[model samples]
Target: MTAPEPYAGVTTHTPVRHHILSVLVENKAGVLARIAGLFARRGFNIYSLAVAPAEGHARFSRVTIVVDAESAPLEQIVGQLNKLVNVVDIKDLAPRDALERELLLATLPVDDGNRAAVLEVVANAAASIVDVNATSLSVVLAGTPHACDLLERALEGFSDVELQRTGRVALPRLTQTESL
Candidate 1:
Protein backbone atom coordinates (compact mmCIF):
# COMPACT_ATOMS: atom_id res chain seq x y z
CA MET A 1 0.00 0.00 0.00
CA THR A 2 1.06 3.57 -0.62
CA ALA A 3 2.24 5.57 2.36
CA PRO A 4 -0.55 7.16 4.30
CA GLU A 5 -0.89 10.91 4.18
CA PRO A 6 1.34 12.70 6.69
CA TYR A 7 -1.50 14.17 8.75
CA ALA A 8 -4.08 11.45 8.18
CA GLY A 9 -4.42 10.45 11.81
CA VAL A 10 -3.89 13.83 13.43
CA THR A 11 -7.53 13.93 14.42
CA THR A 12 -8.96 10.92 16.20
CA HIS A 13 -12.55 9.77 16.30
CA THR A 14 -12.64 9.62 20.06
CA PRO A 15 -12.28 12.76 22.08
CA VAL A 16 -9.21 13.00 24.26
CA ARG A 17 -10.08 12.94 27.93
CA HIS A 18 -8.19 15.14 30.35
CA HIS A 19 -8.17 15.46 34.12
CA ILE A 20 -7.54 18.59 36.10
CA LEU A 21 -5.54 17.90 39.23
CA SER A 22 -5.28 20.46 42.00
CA VAL A 23 -2.23 19.66 44.08
CA LEU A 24 -1.37 21.33 47.33
CA VAL A 25 2.23 21.15 48.36
CA GLU A 26 4.57 22.68 50.87
CA ASN A 27 5.79 25.97 49.45
CA LYS A 28 9.44 25.22 49.94
CA ALA A 29 12.39 25.10 47.63
CA GLY A 30 12.61 21.96 45.47
CA VAL A 31 8.99 20.93 45.96
CA LEU A 32 8.12 21.78 42.39
CA ALA A 33 11.24 20.08 41.14
CA ARG A 34 10.37 16.94 43.05
CA ILE A 35 6.86 16.85 41.64
CA ALA A 36 8.04 17.49 38.07
CA GLY A 37 10.67 14.78 38.43
CA LEU A 38 8.01 12.34 39.56
CA PHE A 39 5.96 12.95 36.45
CA ALA A 40 9.06 12.62 34.26
CA ARG A 41 9.99 9.35 35.88
CA ARG A 42 6.50 7.99 35.32
CA GLY A 43 6.37 9.03 31.64
CA PHE A 44 3.19 11.04 32.17
CA ASN A 45 2.60 14.22 30.26
CA ILE A 46 1.35 17.34 31.95
CA TYR A 47 -0.70 19.20 29.37
CA SER A 48 -0.88 22.34 31.42
CA LEU A 49 0.45 23.46 34.80
CA ALA A 50 0.10 26.57 36.93
CA VAL A 51 1.28 27.17 40.46
CA ALA A 52 0.62 29.90 42.98
CA PRO A 53 0.60 30.43 46.70
CA ALA A 54 -2.49 29.19 48.45
CA GLU A 55 -4.73 31.52 50.42
CA GLY A 56 -4.05 32.63 53.96
CA HIS A 57 -0.85 30.65 54.22
CA ALA A 58 2.48 31.26 52.64
CA ARG A 59 3.54 27.80 53.72
CA PHE A 60 1.41 26.00 51.14
CA SER A 61 1.04 26.39 47.39
CA ARG A 62 -1.54 25.22 44.93
CA VAL A 63 -0.61 23.60 41.64
CA THR A 64 -3.15 23.09 38.88
CA ILE A 65 -2.09 20.42 36.41
CA VAL A 66 -3.94 19.12 33.41
CA VAL A 67 -3.11 15.62 32.23
CA ASP A 68 -4.37 13.41 29.46
CA ALA A 69 -6.37 10.68 31.16
CA GLU A 70 -5.35 8.22 28.47
CA SER A 71 -1.66 8.86 29.01
CA ALA A 72 -1.70 7.41 32.50
CA PRO A 73 -4.47 6.12 34.72
CA LEU A 74 -5.83 8.64 37.21
CA GLU A 75 -5.17 6.43 40.21
CA GLN A 76 -1.58 5.87 39.23
CA ILE A 77 -0.83 9.56 38.77
CA VAL A 78 -2.44 10.48 42.07
CA GLY A 79 -0.73 7.64 43.88
CA GLN A 80 2.66 8.77 42.69
CA LEU A 81 1.87 12.36 43.59
CA ASN A 82 0.81 11.36 47.08
CA LYS A 83 4.09 9.59 47.68
CA LEU A 84 6.01 12.83 47.44
CA VAL A 85 7.13 14.28 50.74
CA ASN A 86 5.88 17.83 50.07
CA VAL A 87 2.54 16.92 48.55
CA VAL A 88 -0.23 17.59 51.05
CA ASP A 89 -3.47 17.12 49.09
CA ILE A 90 -4.76 16.23 45.64
CA LYS A 91 -8.17 17.14 44.21
CA ASP A 92 -9.33 15.96 40.83
CA LEU A 93 -11.53 18.65 39.34
CA ALA A 94 -13.84 17.37 36.66
CA PRO A 95 -14.48 19.61 33.68
CA ARG A 96 -18.05 20.24 34.70
CA ASP A 97 -16.95 21.32 38.16
CA ALA A 98 -14.13 23.64 37.17
CA LEU A 99 -13.52 26.99 35.53
CA GLU A 100 -10.53 27.07 33.21
CA ARG A 101 -8.72 29.79 31.30
CA GLU A 102 -5.55 30.50 29.34
CA LEU A 103 -3.81 33.58 28.08
CA LEU A 104 -2.24 34.17 24.66
CA LEU A 105 -0.09 36.89 23.19
CA ALA A 106 0.37 37.29 19.48
CA THR A 107 2.41 39.69 17.40
CA LEU A 108 1.78 40.07 13.71
CA PRO A 109 3.49 42.04 11.01
CA VAL A 110 1.19 44.86 10.00
CA ASP A 111 1.59 47.17 7.07
CA ASP A 112 -0.85 49.66 5.65
CA GLY A 113 -2.36 46.82 3.60
CA ASN A 114 -3.46 44.74 6.63
CA ARG A 115 -3.45 46.90 9.76
CA ALA A 116 -7.17 47.56 9.77
CA ALA A 117 -7.97 43.96 8.95
CA VAL A 118 -5.91 42.75 11.90
CA LEU A 119 -7.62 45.26 14.18
CA GLU A 120 -11.00 44.01 13.06
CA VAL A 121 -10.04 40.44 13.86
CA VAL A 122 -8.94 41.42 17.37
CA ALA A 123 -12.12 43.41 18.00
CA ASN A 124 -14.29 40.57 16.78
CA ALA A 125 -12.72 38.26 19.35
CA ALA A 126 -12.92 40.77 22.23
CA ALA A 127 -9.14 40.77 22.42
CA SER A 128 -7.03 43.85 22.98
CA ILE A 129 -4.33 45.36 20.88
CA VAL A 130 -1.71 45.87 23.53
CA ASP A 131 0.99 47.51 21.48
CA VAL A 132 1.63 48.70 17.96
CA ASN A 133 4.98 49.44 16.44
CA ALA A 134 5.88 50.70 13.00
CA THR A 135 6.00 47.18 11.61
CA SER A 136 4.11 44.95 14.02
CA LEU A 137 1.03 44.71 16.23
CA SER A 138 0.73 42.81 19.49
CA VAL A 139 -2.46 41.42 20.93
CA VAL A 140 -3.47 39.83 24.22
CA LEU A 141 -6.32 37.40 24.68
CA ALA A 142 -7.34 35.98 28.05
CA GLY A 143 -10.29 33.65 27.99
CA THR A 144 -11.45 30.07 27.91
CA PRO A 145 -9.35 27.65 25.87
CA HIS A 146 -11.85 27.58 23.02
CA ALA A 147 -11.95 31.33 22.77
CA CYS A 148 -8.18 31.53 22.71
CA ASP A 149 -8.05 28.90 19.99
CA LEU A 150 -10.44 30.87 17.85
CA LEU A 151 -8.36 33.98 18.15
CA GLU A 152 -5.22 32.12 17.28
CA ARG A 153 -6.83 30.80 14.14
CA ALA A 154 -8.01 34.25 13.13
CA LEU A 155 -4.53 35.67 13.54
CA GLU A 156 -3.03 33.04 11.28
CA GLY A 157 -4.40 34.85 8.25
CA PHE A 158 -1.76 37.47 8.80
CA SER A 159 1.88 36.84 7.98
CA ASP A 160 4.93 36.82 10.22
CA VAL A 161 3.01 36.07 13.40
CA GLU A 162 4.51 35.17 16.74
CA LEU A 163 2.36 33.66 19.42
CA GLN A 164 2.71 32.44 22.99
CA ARG A 165 0.08 30.86 25.19
CA THR A 166 0.13 30.21 28.89
CA GLY A 167 -1.09 26.72 29.71
CA ARG A 168 -4.47 26.56 31.39
CA VAL A 169 -5.07 27.44 35.01
CA ALA A 170 -8.27 26.31 36.64
CA LEU A 171 -10.23 26.53 39.86
CA PRO A 172 -13.28 24.69 41.13
CA ARG A 173 -16.64 26.14 40.22
CA LEU A 174 -18.45 27.14 43.37
CA THR A 175 -22.02 26.09 43.98
CA GLN A 176 -24.68 28.50 45.21
CA THR A 177 -24.28 27.49 48.85
CA GLU A 178 -20.51 27.17 48.77
CA SER A 179 -17.89 29.74 49.64
CA LEU A 180 -14.19 30.15 48.88
Candidate 2:
Protein backbone atom coordinates (compact mmCIF):
# COMPACT_ATOMS: atom_id res chain seq x y z
CA MET A 1 0.00 0.00 0.00
CA THR A 2 1.14 3.54 -0.64
CA ALA A 3 1.96 5.72 2.33
CA PRO A 4 -0.82 8.10 3.29
CA GLU A 5 -0.53 11.66 2.02
CA PRO A 6 -2.05 13.32 5.04
CA TYR A 7 -1.61 16.87 3.68
CA ALA A 8 -2.74 16.42 0.12
CA GLY A 9 -5.09 19.41 0.06
CA VAL A 10 -8.11 18.05 1.95
CA THR A 11 -8.67 14.57 0.58
CA THR A 12 -11.80 12.48 -0.06
CA HIS A 13 -10.56 8.95 0.30
CA THR A 14 -13.25 8.04 2.82
CA PRO A 15 -16.80 9.01 3.73
CA VAL A 16 -15.37 11.78 5.91
CA ARG A 17 -14.82 15.18 4.28
CA HIS A 18 -12.31 17.78 5.46
CA HIS A 19 -13.35 21.05 7.03
CA ILE A 20 -11.44 24.15 8.06
CA LEU A 21 -12.66 25.77 11.25
CA SER A 22 -11.55 29.18 12.51
CA VAL A 23 -12.06 29.30 16.26
CA LEU A 24 -11.80 32.56 18.15
CA VAL A 25 -11.12 32.16 21.84
CA GLU A 26 -9.96 34.05 24.85
CA ASN A 27 -6.19 34.25 24.91
CA LYS A 28 -5.66 32.82 28.33
CA ALA A 29 -3.70 30.05 29.94
CA GLY A 30 -5.11 26.50 29.74
CA VAL A 31 -7.74 27.39 27.16
CA LEU A 32 -5.88 25.48 24.46
CA ALA A 33 -5.68 22.42 26.65
CA ARG A 34 -9.38 22.56 27.33
CA ILE A 35 -10.23 22.80 23.65
CA ALA A 36 -7.87 19.96 22.79
CA GLY A 37 -9.32 17.78 25.54
CA LEU A 38 -12.82 18.23 24.16
CA PHE A 39 -11.74 16.86 20.80
CA ALA A 40 -9.88 14.02 22.44
CA ARG A 41 -12.85 12.97 24.53
CA ARG A 42 -15.13 13.10 21.49
CA GLY A 43 -12.64 11.23 19.28
CA PHE A 44 -12.39 14.02 16.73
CA ASN A 45 -9.27 13.93 14.59
CA ILE A 46 -7.73 17.34 13.91
CA TYR A 47 -5.64 17.18 10.80
CA SER A 48 -3.84 20.52 11.17
CA LEU A 49 -4.05 23.14 13.93
CA ALA A 50 -2.42 26.54 14.39
CA VAL A 51 -3.14 28.97 17.16
CA ALA A 52 -1.97 32.57 17.44
CA PRO A 53 -3.04 35.97 18.62
CA ALA A 54 -5.84 37.53 16.57
CA GLU A 55 -6.03 41.13 15.35
CA GLY A 56 -2.73 41.96 17.00
CA HIS A 57 -4.52 42.00 20.34
CA ALA A 58 -3.43 39.92 23.30
CA ARG A 59 -6.99 39.50 24.54
CA PHE A 60 -8.09 37.05 21.90
CA SER A 61 -6.56 34.30 19.82
CA ARG A 62 -7.65 32.47 16.72
CA VAL A 63 -7.23 28.78 16.08
CA THR A 64 -7.15 27.54 12.53
CA ILE A 65 -8.13 23.87 12.67
CA VAL A 66 -8.43 21.39 9.88
CA VAL A 67 -10.60 18.49 10.92
CA ASP A 68 -12.39 15.48 9.47
CA ALA A 69 -15.88 16.83 8.83
CA GLU A 70 -17.49 13.39 8.83
CA SER A 71 -16.00 12.04 12.04
CA ALA A 72 -18.98 13.61 13.74
CA PRO A 73 -21.73 15.95 12.66
CA LEU A 74 -20.68 19.58 12.22
CA GLU A 75 -23.31 20.70 14.70
CA GLN A 76 -21.89 18.46 17.40
CA ILE A 77 -18.44 19.91 17.01
CA VAL A 78 -19.80 23.42 17.04
CA GLY A 79 -21.95 22.72 20.08
CA GLN A 80 -19.08 21.22 22.02
CA LEU A 81 -16.85 24.11 21.13
CA ASN A 82 -19.52 26.57 22.14
CA LYS A 83 -19.72 25.00 25.56
CA LEU A 84 -16.13 25.91 26.23
CA VAL A 85 -15.97 28.97 28.45
CA ASN A 86 -13.11 30.51 26.57
CA VAL A 87 -14.39 29.97 23.04
CA VAL A 88 -15.86 33.13 21.55
CA ASP A 89 -16.83 32.15 18.00
CA ILE A 90 -16.48 29.43 15.40
CA LYS A 91 -16.41 30.07 11.66
CA ASP A 92 -16.47 27.35 9.04
CA LEU A 93 -14.28 28.59 6.23
CA ALA A 94 -15.41 26.23 3.48
CA PRO A 95 -12.78 25.65 0.80
CA ARG A 96 -14.49 27.68 -1.88
CA ASP A 97 -15.03 30.65 0.40
CA ALA A 98 -11.56 30.89 1.88
CA LEU A 99 -8.01 31.75 0.96
CA GLU A 100 -5.67 29.05 2.25
CA ARG A 101 -1.93 28.64 2.23
CA GLU A 102 0.84 26.55 3.80
CA LEU A 103 4.58 26.79 4.15
CA LEU A 104 7.04 23.99 3.35
CA LEU A 105 10.71 23.81 4.25
CA ALA A 106 12.77 21.02 2.72
CA THR A 107 16.43 20.15 2.96
CA LEU A 108 17.86 18.14 0.11
CA PRO A 109 21.26 16.68 -0.62
CA VAL A 110 23.10 18.98 -3.01
CA ASP A 111 26.68 18.03 -3.59
CA ASP A 112 28.48 18.40 -6.91
CA GLY A 113 26.78 15.21 -8.11
CA ASN A 114 23.28 16.72 -8.21
CA ARG A 115 23.38 20.39 -7.19
CA ALA A 116 22.22 21.58 -10.60
CA ALA A 117 19.41 19.04 -10.77
CA VAL A 118 18.08 19.98 -7.33
CA LEU A 119 18.20 23.69 -8.16
CA GLU A 120 16.17 22.98 -11.28
CA VAL A 121 13.45 21.33 -9.26
CA VAL A 122 13.31 24.19 -6.78
CA ALA A 123 13.19 26.78 -9.55
CA ASN A 124 10.34 24.98 -11.22
CA ALA A 125 8.31 25.20 -8.04
CA ALA A 126 9.08 28.91 -7.64
CA ALA A 127 10.59 28.13 -4.24
CA SER A 128 13.69 29.76 -2.86
CA ILE A 129 16.77 28.21 -1.36
CA VAL A 130 16.95 29.80 2.05
CA ASP A 131 19.98 27.93 3.37
CA VAL A 132 22.97 26.25 1.81
CA ASN A 133 25.87 24.22 3.11
CA ALA A 134 28.61 22.19 1.54
CA THR A 135 26.35 19.18 1.06
CA SER A 136 22.74 20.29 1.33
CA LEU A 137 20.22 23.00 0.44
CA SER A 138 17.15 24.12 2.35
CA VAL A 139 14.30 25.38 0.20
CA VAL A 140 11.26 27.27 1.41
CA LEU A 141 7.95 27.30 -0.45
CA ALA A 142 4.84 29.20 0.59
CA GLY A 143 1.81 28.49 -1.58
CA THR A 144 -1.34 26.44 -1.94
CA PRO A 145 -1.30 22.89 -0.63
CA HIS A 146 -1.27 21.39 -4.12
CA ALA A 147 1.83 23.34 -5.11
CA CYS A 148 3.62 22.24 -1.98
CA ASP A 149 2.60 18.63 -2.66
CA LEU A 150 4.00 18.78 -6.15
CA LEU A 151 7.29 20.25 -4.92
CA GLU A 152 7.61 17.60 -2.24
CA ARG A 153 6.97 14.84 -4.76
CA ALA A 154 9.58 16.19 -7.14
CA LEU A 155 12.20 16.36 -4.41
CA GLU A 156 11.69 12.65 -3.69
CA GLY A 157 13.90 11.79 -6.65
CA PHE A 158 16.92 13.19 -4.81
CA SER A 159 18.55 11.66 -1.74
CA ASP A 160 18.78 12.69 1.92
CA VAL A 161 15.71 14.91 2.09
CA GLU A 162 14.02 16.23 5.20
CA LEU A 163 10.85 18.27 5.00
CA GLN A 164 8.37 20.03 7.28
CA ARG A 165 5.17 21.94 6.49
CA THR A 166 3.24 24.44 8.58
CA GLY A 167 -0.11 22.73 8.02
CA ARG A 168 -2.41 25.52 6.79
CA VAL A 169 -3.86 28.89 7.75
CA ALA A 170 -6.94 30.22 6.03
CA LEU A 171 -9.11 33.31 6.12
CA PRO A 172 -12.57 33.84 4.68
CA ARG A 173 -12.81 36.08 1.65
CA LEU A 174 -14.12 39.55 2.25
CA THR A 175 -17.49 40.57 0.81
CA GLN A 176 -18.27 44.05 -0.43
CA THR A 177 -20.88 46.08 1.42
CA GLU A 178 -23.74 47.71 -0.45
CA SER A 179 -24.81 51.29 0.24
CA LEU A 180 -28.30 51.52 1.62
Backbone clash count, each prediction separately: 0, 0
Instruction: Give the C-alpha miss distance for residue 9 in model 1, angstroms.
Output: 11
Q: Candidate 2: which pairs clash?
A: none
Cα-based TM-score, every candidate: 0.85, 0.85
Worst 10 residues of 1 by lDDT: 1-10
The Cα error of candidate 1 at residue 121, in Å, is 1.6
Instruction: Name the lDDT of candidate 1.
Output: 0.82
lDDT of 1 by residue, 21-134 (tens): 999999999999998999999998888888989877899999988887888898999999999989999988776677888899999888777777888888988999899889
Error of 2 at 84 (Å): 0.8
Q: What is residue 38's positional error in candidate 1, in angstroms?
A: 0.9
Q: Local error of candidate 2 at 175, Å?
A: 5.8
Q: Which TM-score value belongs to model 2?
A: 0.85
Cα lDDT, model 2, residue 175? 60
How much lDDT does each candidate structure score? 0.82, 0.82
